[model samples]
Target: MNNLTARMRHGVIGVLSVALFTLMSSTAATATDELFGGLTSPHEIDLLSHPEIKQDIQTWRTDAGTQVLFVHSPGLPMFDLVLKIDAGSVRDGDTPGLSALTVSMLNEGTKDYNTDEIAELFERHGAKFSTRYEADSVSVSLRSLSAAEHRIPLVELFAEVVGKPALGATQLQRLKGEMLNQLNDDNNWMPFFLKNELYAQLFRGHPYAQPSGGTPEGIAAVTREALHRFHSQTYTPQNMVISLIGDLALEEAKAIAETVSQALPEGPAQPPIASTPEAEPEVLHFERSNAQTDVMLAFPSVTLDDPDYVAMEIASILLGNHPNARLTNELRHKRGLTYGVVATFMPFKAGGSLQIKWDVEPRYNEASQALVSEMLETFLRNGPTQEELDLARQLFRSEALNSISVNALAVRKISAIGFNGRPLDYIQRQQEEAFALTPEAVRLAVNRNLDLKKSVFISVGPEVPQEPLPELLLITQADE
Candidate 1:
């Protein structure tokens, strides 16, 4: 062997000898007689020791509809109950933000308690009651300690919040005034613009793309009667899931759930979601006078059930997984092109977006676009190398080690199960499936999904140079 090769081999051997000696000496030091046996480091072989999530989740039905029950531990003096109504933004029709306002106003007044009385009830117990809505769900929560004799009263208060929220006209006008004034700021306006433009580009004509927050114009039209109709029709037990945790027995929990369900009217089934276009590529551009350029690039990539979804995730990791990731290296670190860049594969109920977004100096717009294009093109043709794939797997393994908390893992597991409509075993299954993704599988995913020719680019920046700006078809948000 040549001198250099021999020297390299000797260096490796020396390092291994040192590591072995350290391990032996550490083991010897740890071995000692004690009142109790000394322990070795906990077994790394079992990286996942998830809490025993006994999904003895029980269900009961009242004259109203079904109620779901699960045991909870609040570690406090009172019992907390949550009822998640499936009345979401989709039910608001074209009226944006109505669902959010409707939920928030639930605790503002009931037949027995005005807004002040309701707020004071919680303060008396050092607890809280709240209601809010999202695009697909609305949640109501009550918190108190276990030893408190007021568990049943807490249940009744929650029922009142759901059943008889007085949508006072004066209150409606006040909330609308506050929301309208806040929408003109750059941060607030930017988030709305981003969500609306990106989803409209992907899901086009779908209600999912509609604003969940009632628009200023829509909120202006909201009347007390309209909110009443919305409340009576949407909040029902059949469309709801109840979860109670902390200091309640199964029988008591069931009784409380029954009382909450009895308070609501038996509403009609939610209407089917309005049809959305298949996630095809469409270019959307927007203009704003900002100090820094903002950009978002997206393509509809995968659903929760797609077989290649795991490979796509792994590919995303290699593309923008770290400071040394291929995109970061080419676009930011090597070329000093931008502040930072990200590539993410967001798997959702249906197909979702494989999104790459960044902010860069306006002067480098042409170079930034070129670098993104070339990186994607190269990924499509050749994919990641074996060494790159190995490093990515190591990085993902390390991340899993860090994030395996009981609560965090539980949320991840439950969300995956709910979103995919799959069994709870789905998360455990991901560990094996994600690691099994072959390099060729990643290559196929990239080639199939990452189409440079037909993809959307949303840029909110100063003027773009003419050469790069005209290369892609552009539709400004102002027109729509």
Candidate 2:
């Protein structure tokens, strides 16, 4: 840490945090009142004529063993494709920013094309191509015309960027300087302060505890060789999932999948991440130079493989966001302690977390915390009411319907599900399971999955925590 103050960033880096980050860019829908503005209700949509929440996913594998999930839509001549690699920040190991920097450097130049040429190629074909870093994976997504003139050239260019990145010392140093500059400028943009603190304390010793993006020391220490090593080991064909959606035939889709998946060298599969364990109950506070305190209550939730996963999803809906939801009603609607409260589940491969977050004035911070904790306890002890259950079901049904009907949303849905290793019917089953949930089942899930005793409470605001700052954090903040 240098003598200059360390100013934490907020939004941009929020998506890159370690485990339970990304939030899937949120396919989850908001409550009815918020979505429809109360002009119409979610339940008003008739279930009898409602679109089925199903996908005709044509699944296959490339010779290199990359899993492909494809859905054909003949309405438009354009297509959306997504590719996932196991090289998220978790693979950074000792070099925290190694994985993120590696992916960011992908298009700075490739073996056959430079950054300017690559941008020109995409612009020429009217293609939208991007890559994002997640806790468990890195996603490279594209949307372009299906015609060979546009698609063929664009797809090949995509392959070049993914498989043949020109990652060397020059690109490494340039990107490092850019990242450090942003960290220096965005002093007040501490969006993930509470989230970073929460994961640091909650996960403690696990790799999941690592901060996404990277600390100053971590970023400066990242060598060009380390980036190449991380990319090669984790970006292999044996460890990727490809999802394609558009007006193309099965064979055409298969061809596209092949070009992207086989672009990388094969072998050296990613090792499975160890599942997150339950953390003991704890209270933590971050002193932010702000008037209102941002609060987050976190608990270890279900894994993708857990039977209670579906139930946990519904329980989240009932607890927060919805107009009549428990936490919102208690904290904001009835008492007016805050403007909005949100509860979210950040799921990893094996296990994940459920976070209830909100903000309140400094004077009311302690009271808001107690009220939220009490409301959570009562909701767990006594499950959602019949009306609340129906509301959450209707909301889920509406979201599910919209997800499959729209091409843009469906590609993301398919990519997320396939990356997590769920069955083709995972979304469909979740909807069906949510509709059939009895209050008892939801209660069981809330109790079985969330432990009030084990939950960690954290806040960021003007007041410093009673405890002294950790020595590592107290040092002079420098851009190592």
Candidate 3:
């Protein structure tokens, strides 16, 4: 059931207005920006119900101080609920893996249900729940039918899982053993190693350096007492946001939100992460006997709040992220060096990293490294071509529309945005804003922010000829 059929023709394709940075939109019969509140001009004659799709969102705060965001989706008799808590690795304090260990115990045993009993409850009701922790937040999600008989008991069990847990030393040891085994297994996986090492190197003393999953030493240090205390302090209503989307009336949605929020204990929101210091540029190499070399070039980045964020996102797509972007055209298509290459921009709250990562056969190590550097330099010097910018905008717009194409996606996306303090309509605005992003704007952003001298180069694989890598010319302000 694709619902955006009319919207696609009007709002989605209208992004072609960027036509080589000239506002020549020959495709749209009439612009659909008017559909959005104050976002566009509407013609009185051609009033359409759906120019672009956006979910109807209702928001409020519970007595427990949890932010509740509800989307009244009228379709399947089901609901997707997500609780985004502010207790992640950054809040680990002196104990690095405390958050991960804390969440691992949520369903191990509740006040009335043991691990097996909890699993059976979910299966019997055809409900699902999952817990995940990342650098800045922990998410507990549920998918269950909205029918009163199923939803009522499952919601009760969920409340118990989150609010009343029985922590035991034996359970602690078993979970620790499992985490340690995973760490041991992943030790030799070079890509994982590179990511951990890069963050460690880039933010050595900051909490950002801590891995979301605990290290072996940290996992071992986690005790039953520590888990209990951590849970009490961090998993509280004040620090949480609830996202509920599915078939339900406003009153029913509000009742569910209250139940979930009121079940949590009261506590204050945690403090912000400390200021992240800038990382100095360096060249690093790690030794391993592998068939190919994995290379990464990283430049420090500002947060999403930065004005140039959208432009940089476009630059990442133009550089190597897109299928037919410059790097793929040069390395994979023209030279057949490797099957893939990717450019990633991490938009951390404090600061971030713009990294281009690729693996190439050992024989082409130096050639590939020089080629990557050359391509980056050329992009910084001249910026993305008109076609590249237009294509990137087209792709971005498509992704934004597709974001809410289903219930689960909308629930997760809206929840994340609400938790991160963005407007519910941010996605829709981004889709419309993509059309206004010009190539010159992207060029200025890339030139100002993506300096090679500021990037740290890292390569991991068996040693090859240690040829000095080519030097990149610094793009001057005048270059833009």
lDDT comparing candidate 3 with the true structure = 0.76
lDDT of 2 by residue, 88-161 (tens): 87787887777778888988898788888989999999998888876788888889999989998999999989
Go through the candidates in order and give each one's C-alpha lDDT.
0.64, 0.76, 0.76
Error of 3 at 429 (Å): 1.5
lDDT by residue (tens digit), candidate 3, 411-439: 88888888878877777666555667778
Predict model 1's lDDT versus the native.
0.64
TM-score of 1: 0.75
Ranking by TM-score: 2, 3, 1
Which residues of candidate 1, in runs, are more than 4 Å off? 1-64, 67-82, 148-150, 186-192, 305-315, 347-351, 385-420, 445-454, 464-480
- What's each prediction's TM-score? 0.75, 0.85, 0.85
Q: lDDT for model 2, on a 0 to 1 scale? A: 0.76
**Rank order (by lDDT, best first):** 2, 3, 1
Q: List the residue pairs that clash in candidate 3.
A: none
Over 276-337, each residue of candidate 1 has an lDDT whose tens digit, in order, gives: 45666565556677766777777767666677766777788898867767887766655555
